[model samples]
Target: MIHLKNVHKRFQKPEGGWFDAVRDTSLHVRAGEIFGLIGFSGAGKSTLLRLINLLERPDSGSVTVDGQPLTALSASALRRARQNIGMVFQQFNLMANRTVAANIAFPLEIAGWQQADIDARVAECLDIVGLADRAQHYPAQLSGGQKQRVGIARALAPRPHVILADEPTSALDPKTTQSILDCLQDINARFGVTVVIVTHEMHVIRSICHRAALLDAGEVVEILSVQDKQVSAQSALAKSLLEVA
Candidate 1:
């Protein structure tokens, strides 16, 4: 449901040079599967995720999501298309001042939903994230896991076709990570939203990903299926990660 072909992206370094964030990277994410981009810091995993939603446009290649060429869309069309592509971030990115319900309602409000519809969607999303009783809670009052759950609820409130999660469990403890992973897995099975997760942790990939691309230095080295081996991702870095663990 998503494709990136020969994509390249770079940024100006603060030291007066160009740094390539993504280098001729190509990847495909099948529908209704959790695809993980596994790599270390500076490996461009996050940049790759942004390309799928056109948050970071490629310098040279094509980005297609759900059969639409994201790079070819006009600004207005892209805005409309983005509603079908929800994103969950590592930092939670919640407005400290807004309650969980209000935070989840922000996207629906932006999409011009009626107040009644927004209220229904927000409550439904809170229930999905198992935070129905926390609707009135603010970010400052919640735990790290709770904050991330709120982020997930906000992403789901739009009922997007695809969900791009960037290191969704990086901030939490091991137990909390498992809970979030389970939530993601449940969401995938129940909603059939194509999930693409970016993370440096091999445990994250092995835990929930059906298919994964091993990335290094902004290039994908190998693609592995969890159902086939049920272990490591089978790349050199992946082996190293297993060894370290």
Candidate 2:
């Protein structure tokens, strides 16, 4: 339900010339599937994720999600469109002052949801992420894993059609990472939300992704498939990435 065609994104380097973050990349993600963008540091995986929601508008080409051409939308239109797309950041970007319920309620409130409806949705999301008992707790009071669960709950509060997770498990330990991935998988299975995750860890892809695009230096070098918990690597780069897994 997401497509990028000949997309290019660049940023002005403070030193001088421009640096290409995404270079003529094209890919499609099917609805209700978990897709992965795997790459090393500076590989543009994060930039590509932001491009899907136009958080970082592409310098050229098109971005379409759920059949809507996001690149052609006006400011207000884009803002409305973004409500259907949720984002989970690597660093758990929660408000320090807001309680867990309030943090999840923030987006629904901004969407003009009635207080009663927002309250119900926040409770549902908290339950989904296994954080129902922590609703009154502030971000500072939670452990790293609990904070990430709160982030996930907040992202799900809006009933989004797609979730863009940029390194959602990178901050947690191995056991915690497994739980987070399982949570994402459960969300995908139970709710049918399309997930496009950016992660450098091959195990993350193998554990959850059905298909993945391997990127290098701002370009897509390969598209690998995972079946029966096995990743099929076609290119040398893909093989190398798997070797490091």
Candidate 3:
């Protein structure tokens, strides 16, 4: 379970005092569901995601994950906790200098897994993402879809309880995007990992999310649930955005 109550975030404006990025945001994402944070540019979707992992601390509020206060943890403790929280970026953050298996094994190595264990885990992850044949290949040699698959593989390597993806498909074409979304769905269904995705595209939410939180001007304006082929929206902003997307 993930919960944030009255969460707020601010940033210093370029030529002035301050601007709110996220304001009094509160939402809970249930375990084993794919939840989406959807909004247009500058809607604070990414910032809200950062707050969940403490990559960006909230100005004030409680950030509780599995009943643990992430905001109150010591640096070392937070680091340890993060091992079970995987992150997949918009750009596949793979190392150009490393092979696919090596890139996937990076986290296990940091956690001090033995070489044998790392190899086995990396192989399994590769197989899961359908990149077993590309284990020895470099990032530059892969297609965009292939790269994102590798990113998914790397994120799942730790067997994390939750996966946070930030605009992961924004860089891909339609067909590629669908494949990536399918991969995410597969992981959630097969592993029971709670997945929270940040996306501006409404089709993304419509396609895979069990529930979605709509944000506008730093605040959550609506929450939409997708079930039985019906999508209901309570906020005008959400309805408008849905129409546009």
Writing each residue's lDDT as its tens digit, candidate 1 over 121-239 gives 89889989999999998899999999999998888888998999999999999999999999999999999999999988878878889988888888887887787537545567778
Indicate which candidate wins on lDDT. 2
- Model 1: lowest-lDDT 10 consecutive positions: 227-236
What stretches of model 3 exceed 4 Å from their correct place?
none
The TM-score leader among the candidates is 2
What would you estimate as the lDDT of candidate 1?
0.90
lDDT of 3 at 127: 91
Summarize candidate 2's per-residue lDDT along 68-176 as a digit string, tens digits.
9999999999988898998899999999999999999998998999999999999999999999999999999999889989888888889999999999999999999
Clashing pairs in 1: none
- Taking the tens digit of each residue's C-alpha lDDT, what string does model 3 give over 122-147? 99999999999999999999998999
For candidate 1, the per-residue lDDT at 16 reads 98
Which sections of candidate 2 miss by over 4 Å? none
What lDDT would each prediction earn against the true structure?
A: 0.90, 0.94, 0.92
Error in Å for residue 174 of model 1: 1.0
Ranking by TM-score: 2, 3, 1
| Decoy 3 TM-score against native | 0.97
The true-versus-predicted C-alpha distance at residue 78 of model 1, in Å, is 0.5
Q: Each candidate: RMSD to true structure?
A: 1.3, 0.7, 1.0
